[model samples]
Target: MARATMDVMSSAPGDQAETPTTSASEREPTPAELAAQQGVPARGASHYAKGTSANMMRSMLVIVGIGLALFLVTARPNSVTPESVDVASAAQYRGGQAGQPFAYAEGLPDGWVATSVRYARSKGDVMVWNAGYTTPDAQYVSVQQAVDPGQDWVDTQTNQGRVIGRIETDDGTRWVQRDREGKVQRSLVHVPDDRTELTTLVTGTGSWEQLEEFAEHLTPAKVTKAGSSPSVSTSPAS
Candidate 1:
């Protein structure tokens, strides 16, 4: 029985271990295998191309938005206009009465609009009257009158201009012309033998001809009491 068992064991295969299997992480990948992987693109060229296309689209949208904003801002229209004023009525309300030693303008030409008028006590106890107007060409013109003012007052009014020449009006009144940088000033002094002296100045950004026209229309008047209400009898030019 022992001999039969030994013959059967010898006939069987020799005792050898099977080969061990390798894990996925420990194995190397081929180039074709990597190329077939999903969710990943090729390096450099394709990736930069997609990124550049997206950036260009965003930049174009921003440029279009800025252009639209500028057009809206510049094309808007103005909806309101400024109100006009009456100089004569304003002067009357500010103590311009008959027989007062003040200066005023009458028979102003067409297209001239008075914007302001004032009468106030100034330095050296002198009374000053001023009336501002907008000329036909939209330039600024003003008539300033002072009672017994100093030469310094005249200098200040003329912007320290030097006397250029003299102009004689139709009424035999002589006006002194002063040349200042960016302005023209014409002044006249009235010294009555029985009354106080008066100085009238026509100064403005208007042309010399416009200033002369303003000076020609000026007339001397007197201030009445304060708080006087006067009627305006003039109309604006068409």
Candidate 2:
């Protein structure tokens, strides 16, 4: 029998004049049946699904991040910044004393020093003698501090530090300094027995080639013994 001439059936319809329609019971399925009927959704319904997938994912990530952050915050117990050191100039900070402290070198441009602070580091041979120079304008810091704000070499490097490569001038003198973010300003000195060394870390701003001219002037000196004091001066810059 042809389908056009028979009653509705899963298979081909047999020869019958009547076509069957689904009953209300069949049309309105049970909850399980309805669920099954909607199981593998149609492509159209899938797009409009009310799901919180994105929000759930974001929440999961935030939880995980909070867990990790908590661990990090609790693991160590110290300030990230360096300690406030007393100014210890080379002349004032002596190696031998009742309670000896570390000594640091202080370099100031002429007419830059308001008063020389003679103090000792609580720790090493390194001395830090801060020159109490007034800020030119209403500024509360040195021009260098305004221009280049660095607590020290390690602080600068450890913090938002920059790497300025070797810059050698035309003359024999070279200037090594920690740049402002990555610009040049100060002179860093390293000394050996027979020679003096200079290192300039310019952060990401400078290229090795850009500092090459300044690097040519530096003469690397080996580390000298602690007892002897060497003169700190600039040679003829290259």
Candidate 3:
């Protein structure tokens, strides 16, 4: 009986020593716990951050596009009018200085704005009077009065256009219409009277009808003589 008891005690001790036991800290961690320990963001948080960045970029692009559109709309060429210049005074003053009858535009309706005026000598030493205007429809037209201009001067002023046809105005003067293909239009007239030796040219990108209208408004201008308070005469071209 003592030997059986000793064997039982020895077996019980051996079983206790051989059996394995696990603690909470020694077990393998779950996926979620591993991710947390590795500092990985959650799926929901990652998606939210990406969505916010994309939305911000889209909003910035939309704002920039809207600003560009507004700028283009406000800066259109047709919406702006050029500053108006005084043709009558310039014609009178230049005519007085040059001792000639300079022509000026008169009785024009609203929206006809004179843009430029100058009196200068050409390449052939010919004195010329120039005036430019913008029509109501935003078309450009200019008048050049030169004393005995040569063919080269005419070609230069008319942009090397060829004579298309002739047109007679209310007065006895006749004008030739010249055009360059896809370029400019010109109306040219010669005043070879005993008193005046002038060649008048109307040129621009405007239509023929608009050019004719501008030519009809040209009026002969008289100037005050140098050092004399002489009176000037004004006449209509119609």
Q: How are the candidates ranked when ordered by lDDT, highest leading?
A: 3, 1, 2
Q: After superposition, how far is residue 171 of candidate 1 from its true place, in Å?
A: 2.1
Error of 2 at 167 (Å): 5.0
TM-score of each: 0.57, 0.25, 0.66
Worst 10 residues of 2 by lDDT: 138-147
- Model 3 regions lying over 4 Å from their true place: 1-53, 56-63, 66-70, 73-78, 191-196, 227-238
Residue pairs clashing in model 3 are: none
Per-residue lDDT tens digits for candidate 1, residues 1-238, read 8666555555335754333356787788765567668545545454435768787888789999999999888866432222456665555555444235555677888878776666666667767777778787887788877655877887877788787778877777778888775644444433234335566778877887888888888765545665566655343221
Question: If candidate 3 were superposed on the true structure by all CA atoms, what would the RMSD be?
Answer: 17.2
- Residues 22-41 of candidate 2 have per-residue lDDT tens digits of 67876766666666688953
Positional deviation of 116 in candidate 2, in angstroms? 4.3
Candidate 1 vs 2: which has more TM-score: 1
Quickly count the clashes in candidate 3: 0
**After superposition, candidate 1 runs with Cα above 4 Å error:** 1-82, 93-101, 123-125, 182-195, 221-238
